[model samples]
Target: MTNATTDAMTDATADAPLGRSAVFTILTTGYTGSTGPGVAATVSYVHDGDRHVIVDPGMVASRDRILGPLAELGLGPDDITDVVLSHHHPDNTMNVGLFGRARVHDHKAIYENDQWTDRDAEGHELTPSLRLIRTPGHSREDITLLAGTTEGTIAFVGDLWWRPNGPVDDPVSPDRVTLRTSRLRVLAAADVIVPGHGGPFKADETAPV
Candidate 1:
């Protein structure tokens, strides 16, 4: 691990994955549906073939619902090596402090050159993976990571789809004109679609993208 200074951020990591391409595993916290917002507090993790990264921890839920299930997966809050947040929203970032020594990553625009958030105050590596894309429709900080390893180019659209049951909410996305088009674009590439919450799905599945 390196320091959090700007000097520490090298170019994006372009190394090809060594294992069976790269596998991303997601562990969800819970779902939320209300008249105002239908978002779910879905947290997840991905093993980039380099190490483990828990993307978002989400709001406090039943221990069994959140951390306990992760513990069953041979992971605990402490085992999370890195946390990459989609945005600084309260639902996605509330449990960040649980990472302990784990590093936290967000776009430079999200956290700047600072080290440490309320959780894992010693966060580092704003851009760890290669081909990280910045798609800022959901929020100014929204980012998507693209990996071109043998796994067939995986793309992680932070909160772009929240949960992957649908691509982009057609109504709220770009006046709803481009929602279906964007979802097809996302489905064409990437073998696996890993959302911010719940489990991953094959790119062709009806699951969220």
Candidate 2:
């Protein structure tokens, strides 16, 4: 995952467009580089005016390495306000509970009552300024967040698409495919996109149109 916009078209969403000025440092980048081998995951961060969140923290394989980099930025897990998982895959959610007292903010598809559950496709309002968009294909729980307004809408898509070069992995479920296509239309109309695995991205690059 290089940048956000390069993530995917369908099965994704965006929320209010946050500015670079607000983003501070990567609490951690779980892993970088390509998959396989000694490569691990990378964790990144963004500052919503003092409210901090850490999206998709990688596995233990290399999560420790990311800590050093985050320290350089003068931040730790305790400093985070929320922990947002892209989806339910353990590669990203295995160590999710290790963080501080930040309440997890994920899509309703995978989010159970204090647990992760699977459900049919449906959209809901996550917060006052964000819309939780459901994008099934990748296990039905795959969801993308859409910001309230274009002024700073950032869609945090988790595993809807791969990094640098990858497409949304569609499933055989006709129902899910139908939902994915519809979500693509929404992606085409977003502003900023903060992907789960990659960095942040703008709207136009991956818009389905």
Candidate 3:
């Protein structure tokens, strides 16, 4: 990545709230692919009231990189009250042990452990402002979080769409049909999408210019 891109990633990272909650995305070089433009995964956090909810914390090695941005904003692991994994992938859910003070959440099918929360099959209402969405495809337990923001709805979807090497393509997942169904469901309501292996982009701007 260029210096400009790196700087943009840091500058645009944590420090503000998207809606009434403190939400931001942190990109780490934990898993960059050869053909991937910026194979960095996005680890997002939403501070709803006193609850600090982290979405897809990325690999275990990315803990510091993830915490660096949080520290800059005067936050830390103790501040994290919840950890929501979009799926059980190592890159997305490996750092669950880092947050001892937080509760882990994932799809019921993937998380049968007593420590982790596997809510209703239809998904759970995290808060009045935040809701969990089941968007299985990449994995049977894949999920997405919809945060009601002042700008509109922002969907934190893990691997719902990928732009390998900067080219937006229908990235391969476990099931194409289910992926398409999830995409359509999210597109119908999401204004912005925070993808797994890329940066954030406006949903409407995803169309060909």
TM-scores for every predicted model? 0.63, 0.62, 0.75
Each prediction's RMSD over C-alphas, in Å, is 9.3, 7.0, 9.7
Superposed model 3: Cα runs more than 4 Å off: 1-22, 25-31, 34-39, 60-62, 109-118, 164-172, 205-209
List ranges where model 2 is wrong by over 4 Å: 1-39, 109-131, 147-151, 168-179, 182-186, 199-202, 205-209
Among these predictions, the greatest TM-score belongs to 3
* Candidate 3 colliding pairs, count: 1
How far does residue 120 in candidate 3 sit from its true spot (Å)?
2.5
Give a tens-digit lDDT track for model 2, residues 1-209: 32433455422433232332344344443333444544334355545545566666656465565556666777777776766666677666766765656656665543423765554324554345544556655555666655444354556665554342323443323355554553464456466555444555565645322
Ranking by lDDT: 3, 1, 2
The Cα error of candidate 3 at residue 194, in Å, is 0.3
**How well does candidate 3 match the true structure in TM-score terms?**
0.75
Tens-digit lDDT string for candidate 3 (1-209): 45653453354233122344435555343344532343445778776666688888875444677888878778888888877788876667666776777777777633423554435524465666677767887678888877777676787877666432322334446677666566656665567777776667776635211
Cα error, residue 116 of model 2, in Å, equals: 10
Error of 1 at 169 (Å): 3.7
